[model samples]
Target chain A: MRKISAEKIIAVISRLCIQSNCQINEDLITSLKHARGKEQGRARMVLASILKNIKIAQREKLPVCQDTGMAIVFLEIGDKLKIDLGEFLSLSALVQEGVRRGYQSGYLRKSIVEPLSRVNTEDNTPAIIREKIVAGNRLKIKLLIKGFGAENMAKTSMLRPDAGEAGIKRFTLDSVKKAGSHPCPPMVIGIGIGGTMQKAVSLAEEALLEPVKSKRAYFRGCPGLKSKIKRLEEELLREINQLNIGPAGLGGETTALSVKIKTFPTHIAGLPVAVNISCWANRHQEIIL
Target chain B: MKTKRIFAPLTSEGIKKLETGDEVLLSGIIYTARDAAHQRMTKNLKKLPFDLKGQIIYYTGPTPPSPGKIIGSCGPTTSYRMDPYTPSLLKLGLKGTIGKGERSQEVKEAIKRYSAVYFIAFGGCGALYSQFIKKTTLIAYLDLGCESILKLEVEDFPLLVGIDACGRDIYQQQKT
Candidate 1:
């Protein structure tokens, strides 16, 4: 068994919280540049400002957006890996400690609030953690800092099994159209198809972590299923951009930078679909130990 | 495409001249207030931190500044959240507001009724916007942390006139 120290895990999570919020990933930067090239008028101007903001954030070691966002941590632990939980009751406590330290030290905003009382959780604690056990002995930690602007626009639907792909397409397009400019334009669209309602939503959130137009080779399914998903992603990207919501929704040909879809097998009688929209600053980072 | 330079504490004539889609470089003082502060201010109108006459409120809740920085990543939040409280503030002679996203028809009509303007700072451009903010002073609601009312002195802040005093809305104009 490979033992990972609690201290190491906490330190890594802390660093990731700060790093992910401050840095714009290369793939997203490239996608934004491509979108900028295709934009004109106000859209072009918005893109220019966004690109400059990314640079300033990096140079100054500041968050790309003021809404540092709620931390969503994904941990894939290897079956053979064991965590030494020193002084902490569980792995989750360590993760939350990391987030608290990171947000405090990084000067990131404390955005999470008690839903009903609307009181701020000053240190940005209790991150949403998703864990899975995989085959290898390596531990992989992925952090997605989700801002509320786009998150508020997320949607899920239980479509009829007969509805199939066409249903998903219509639902996604309608959601984006209805969203208009609120979620911030040139957004990244994450779609989850199949699975139960909550599972589909989680899958969509996971899809946002994938780099734009990048293929996932690890999908376990039929031989051609991966390619089929890729094709659908491309089609969705095309149609979403054609909406003309544009950059900042001021009007242009580049409304969405990318559309990623993740699928899982569901009950034969039910088809669940969920859409998670992320703003241009789709902040996420991963580390493997 | 021509950039018009304007100062805050906006004048009625100045606001009246601005049309939808006019690019503006705003300087001078504006105040920052987001959802929490807005709710508090609108709820207790008798004890406002400052006079609303001719002032602009930026709908933003910036990250805490790092050491030696005037402010952290500071950009516009969605404007529509403040739609409920906006007409009242506009009625109180608030000259303009800065935020991102479309406003309701009620707010647009109120803008016309009160001869106020609405400007949009580039959404998600927090880091870029930070450079324009010269100074920030906490004005009220200290308990709200980042959502506290702050008096910010800005210089050459980029903005696009979204809704002008005449009720012309850039969002509506651009959509068609």
Candidate 2:
């Protein structure tokens, strides 16, 4: 078993937290510019200006988008990991330490509050991490910092088994319509199908981490699954863009740039569907070591 | 449409010239308080902590500041979350409010009643927004930490007026 230093994990995630708060993945920029080409009217111009701002923020070492989202951590651990659960706490103290350090050092805005009290901690720390133990020797980490603007607009439904594909499509369309201009147009969509309620949410989030290109590491893990999900995603992408939500929810054809679906075998009693909407800036990156 | 620059710590005249659909670039003093502050502001029977008259309030709870910086990556939170307490603040003679997302009808009606406007400075552009905020100070509610009311001095901040006093909401105009 190779030794992995605890401090090293803490340090890397710290930098990642700050970097996620500062820079958006360049892939999202490319996708957005492509979407911009497909749009018209004020929506198109809004996208054009957004492109300009992205450049400005990058050159100046500033955050690419506003609404510096709440911090989310995805951890992939390997077997024979030597870290003590006793040291890990109920969750991991190191993770929270990274959040505290990252947000404070990076000057990221803190957004957590005493839930009901609604007080802001302003550190943006006390982040959320979802971790799993998988077949591996090294650790992998991904930060998909999510802003409230887009997160607030996410919707999910527990569809009846007989709802069928047509019903699914109609529900998806209705949800987007109800969301309308709120989630910020030109959104990246993650559709989760065929899972339990909570699992569906996880699947949607997992799908968001997939690469904008056709080949995705997350999807690669499960053999023969890509083509099936890929077709559904592209079809949904076409339908959502047709809605004309545009950039910033202004009317136009490019409301959604791309849609990716992730499915899991669920109990026959439930067919849960969830939509995880992300704004134009798909600010996420992964490190698999 | 062409945009014009205006200063915050707004005046009655500043409030008047602004109409629905007019884009504005604001400078001068601004304040930030999110959901918690709204609750307390509405809950207290006592006098409010600040002279809210003619002040612009930004509905945001930014990232904490790094070493030596005045504030963190600051951007607007959703406006609708604070809708419940907005009418009372408007009646207290506040100039304007900035936030991301939309507002409720009650707040809109209160805005019309008080002749105040709502502006937006981009939803997730925290890094961009922080650049305009030249300085910041904790004004009140220290117990609340980041939710504590903050006094921010800004310059050349760009925004679009989402709602105007004459009973017009740009979102409403856009929808109809």
Q: Over the stretch A1-289, how does candidate 1's per-residue lDDT look in tens digits?
A: 8999999998999999999999989999998898788777788989999999999999998899999999999999999999999999999999999899999999999998888888888999879999999998899999999998889889999999999789999999999998888888889889998889998999899999988868772255678988888888888888988888888889998888888888888999999999999998899999999
- Expressed as tens digits, the lDDT of each residue in B1-176 for candidate 2 is 77888987888787888987677889998888887888888897366878888899998776666566666667777788798889888888887999865679998899888888898655556666777789998888888765779899988887878888876876666556
lDDT (C-alpha, whole model) for all candidates: 0.91, 0.76
Looking at model 1 chain A, report the run of 10 residues with the lowest lDDT sum.
A213-222
Kindly list the per-residue Cα lDDT of model 2 for residues A1-289, writing each as its tens digit. 7556667777788788767756767678788788778777666766776776676566666666546668889988888666533455644688787787876676565667657656567566678889999886877899888876788878899998888667677877887777766666677778888768898889888878877765552353457677767666777778887776666655678777777787877677768999888876777867865
The CA lDDT at A84 in model 2 is: 38
Best by DockQ: 1
RMSD of each: 1.2, 3.0
lDDT of 2 at A194: 74
Q: DockQ values for all predictions?
A: 0.84, 0.41
- Residue runs of model 1 more than 4 Å from their true location after superposition: A217-220
Question: Could you tell me every candidate's TM-score relative to the true structure?
Answer: 0.98, 0.89
